[model samples]
Target: MTRPARRIARTAAAGAAVLLALSACSSQGSSAPEASGSSPSSRKLSGTVTVFAAASLKESFTALGRQFERQHPGTRVTFSFGGSDTLAASITAGAPADVFAAASTRTMALVTDREDAAGTPVTFVRNQLEIATLPGNPHKVSSLKDLTRSGLKVVLCDRTVPCGAAAREALDTAGLTLTPASYEQDVKSALTKVELKEADAAVVYRTDVKAAGDKVEGVEFPESATAVNDYPIALLKDAPHTAAAKAFIELVRSPRGLKVLSEAGFLAP
Candidate 1:
């Protein structure tokens, strides 16, 4: 071959090699982000996820919150447990919260109606009312009607809260009514009354009674079936940590979340 032809061929081969190297480098650079970005684990969540939940969900949601924080290394889960109505009011009053888990659909409506909820609330669990009496056969509270006994010092959640509302429904279904000695703001507060022996019996959730363990004895009634409360959860409209909030809610609706809630005596939704 002629020298000029050979030189031209050598230069062209070198140029091709350089272009191939550049192309390979470009491919690696472009694909790296796409590959990593597509992975679920690669989307790490950070910041605090503040959850406002019903008083009845204290135990199960706390377990789920810990699980969420463990799954997301840089994330933290904070909870504010109270009456569903109070939580709903707080959310509507510009409270900064990532999530809201209410004990009843009616209470959840308070938030959704005000446009404080980011999406439609999903019911995760259902709870029923039970008569929580002091340990032993002190009261022998056998039925919902028994709670209406004249001398029984009964406490009830206020008519506004989910637990209170459920109790009211159950009482109404039984065609009976008894004035409570005191009306508490939340289920925990009403349960606390019995736990502390301040009241002979209190109408509270089965879950709360289970949580109370030996502190209070649970007496189930047939009327509870008609008044079961459906617990719903949702993301708030003005969440500070949107990503973390979504992850937390996903964890709550996952299989593990159901397991924890089931163990807490919460029935499936």
Candidate 2:
């Protein structure tokens, strides 16, 4: 073999090795944009998210909030659970909430109408009314009509709240006029009455009864079919923790959130 031919062959091999190295570097750089913070999920969200959710969502939302805080180590989730109407009023009055989750669209509208919501509300779950009675249903209350029995210390949600509206619709469907002994401000209050055995029964959401666990028994009534509450959640306008609030909302609509909610006796919308 000639000297020139040998030198040419050696140079060609070196150039090919350099090209392969450059190609490998380029391939790795293009495949992992996440290292450059291109993925939102890759970012660690830091800040507190103030959430105003319906009374019925206290348990499930609390679970999701903790999960969110765990996923974002530096983040904190604060919640104010109450009647949807009361929450709506607070939001409209400029409450410091990053997100709002209402039990009914009507209450959600109060926020959206006032431009307090960042966007159109999304329905996350549906709830049906159930008669929450003493453990084992000692009163033997099987239907809505039973709630109207004389001398039965029954408590009902205020007519302004979502649960109360649903109870009204259910009673209307059954053609029954129930005169509850007291009208509670929220579903939790009404359910609490039954849990403490202070009231014979209360018309509340099935999820409420489930949250109460063995403390109370849930009785499904056919009239509940006429009134199903749709829960809508949305991020608020100009949230202090905009990114965290958005992330929280996404988590609630995610499969993980759905699993927690389903186990609480809430139906998917």
Candidate 3:
């Protein structure tokens, strides 16, 4: 089935459960979310579901995992979140994972091609590049071109990652080029360079900046239109826990999952 159809199906399957959680949270106080990466269930479902996710999805996915646990009591979800390339490499190496959620399809293709994916992958969300800089107009960095300022110390994702590919397209679209002082392996690392004031700015997802929450400010640039990237998730063919993994993927595509991801700044697939 196509990704949109998979999403619709997953939503239909998981929406009611998530909506119940939302309703419960609304009426009662929220308990601390489950340990970092676990599914939620009413009967304390006991099983280990490992997830390989992109570094960019850290905050949002972590929250989702917690909610999953709150909903399904005993399901333990372990996650390895980092650069898509790095995570893909691990899965290819026989890392026992139930689910794979990548920042880009190119990386997911690596696993799927090797018959590592359980089935055809689905695009769950879309993200675009945004420039992150110090709060306020301190540097007067207003556009993509502004990132080329003489004193600016910019950081970018290594070319192997999806964000870097998008950044390349954005720069090419603007008819301007920049020399980043460093190329980090993932968007979070690039954002970290800026957060620590090690670099003057970075190009990353709007959600990354949102995750930072006051740590850094995001500036959307028009050229980002040409550089939008898609996020794809799938169940691993060799997953130790396929049934659980499929359920988690369903949650992500479900209306409840979409609401969470959308609130975190991801565009719906």
Best by lDDT: 2
For residues 178-201, what per-residue lDDT tens digits would candidate 3 score against the true structure?
Answer: 999999999999999988989889
Off by over 4 Å in 2: 1-40
Task: Report the lDDT of model 2 for residue 29.
Answer: 91
Question: Ten residues in a row with the worst lDDT in model 3?
Answer: 34-43
Model 1 clashing-pair count? 0
CA shift of 134, model 2, Å: 1.0
Steric clash count of candidate 3: 12
Cα RMSD of predicted structure 1: 4.3
Instruction: Quote each prediction's TM-score.
Output: 0.86, 0.86, 0.82
lDDT of 2: 0.91
lDDT of 2 by residue, 1-269 (tens): 79999999999999999999999999999878746755334577899999999999999999898999999999999999999999999989988989999999999999999999998899999999899899988889988888888888999999999999989988888899988889999999999888888899999998998888899988999989899999999999968988889889889998999999999999999
Per-residue lDDT tens digits of candidate 1, residues 1-269?
A: 99999999999999999999999999989988897666332477899999999999999989888888888898999999998899899899999999999999999999999999898899988988888999994878899899888999999999999888888888898999789999999999999998888999999999999998999888999999999989989989999998789878888888988999999999999
lDDT of 2 at 72: 91
Ranking by lDDT: 2, 1, 3
